[model samples]
Target: MGSLVASRPVYIPLSPCPRLPAPCSSWYSCSPYCLLQILVTFENLAAWGRCLCAVCPSPTTIVTSGASAVVCVWELGMAKGRPRGLHLKQALYGHTQAVTCLAASVTFSLLGTIVSCAGAHLSLWNVNGQSLASITTAWGPEGAITCCCVIEGPAWDTSHVIITGSQDGMVRVSVSWAE
Candidate 1:
């Protein structure tokens, strides 16, 4: 009889830190995913749930969505070439379905501006645990929002447009002028 062999997974290291592409100098460190990477992983409890989408608005902060409708904001950082791990800062609640999309403005004045979409609902938030604005549309099941992007107007102008796409092949445009 032949003996059974156990299989193991291979780990490949990602090295994107050193490579700073061209336009990064004009926009700071956002070229390489805003200079943030999940270099090290800390164990998340079962209650933490599964991350659906994640983004880093700044070096010291990360915003993430899960399989549930709740949104989580985490504090992440490094210390002496070592990962400091993730710290739960806040849990945002409002959506009735899983948040599948997220976008953060890259402008300097609006560094913490975040937009997250779930089902037909869109919400605007700041990294400091504030809900700026929210809107819900009766898009039905086929009109679930699938993607979104933050279009920053100007440093002095608070008015901006939020573009979103849906599963029903329709595009949505929303405007926000609040802080």
Candidate 2:
């Protein structure tokens, strides 16, 4: 259930580990590809919360969400010629419950969407961090959603599809297009 994005900007879901000066953990050794972008601490995000889900949209950035009920955009920067770490580039808010799943639109090069699942609802955020829209996973109860994916829309069809699944064994597919 827990996995990192296999893309350029690898993302690791983590909770702040005390004792060590850094994000603390032995698992970091398994992932030698990513330079480890930890949110040691930030402005008002004292309760940064645990990272439940993440997706890398760009080579230098990753989108993460969890118990904080908000989406965070992190950018990797270099220091002294070494990969420094992540900088809080931006934050997207609106979901009331903890977001558990995230998916990036393939059309993101055109300012694509990032779909996040909180409870039984899905919230769409633009690559620019703007909250676009929110929708219920299904008309009938299907329990809390566990995962989601955004299928890119074809050239002939301007509508993309969002697929969501839950612990209750229900999968819902919905079509969405930019207006």
Name the candidate that leads on TM-score.
1
Cα-based lDDT for every prediction: 0.72, 0.73
Q: Residue-wise lDDT of candidate 2 within 62-174, one digit each (tens)?
A: 78899988888787665665444577887888888899999987646654788998888899877788777898765444578989998876655656688889878998888
Root-mean-square deviation of Cα positions for candidate 2 versus the true structure, in angstroms: 10.4
Worst 10 residues of 2 by lDDT: 1-10
The residue-by-residue lDDT of candidate 1 on 17-125, one tens digit each, is 4456654532345333443334555554347567788877667777788688778877775688655667778889877788999888775244347888888889988
Per-structure clash totals for the candidates: 0, 1
Give the Å error, residue 110, model 1. 6.3
Cα error, residue 51 of model 2, in Å, equals 1.0
- Regions of candidate 2 where Cα sits further than 4 Å from its true position: 1-46, 78-82, 139-142, 154-158
Q: What is the lDDT of residue 157 in candidate 2?
A: 68
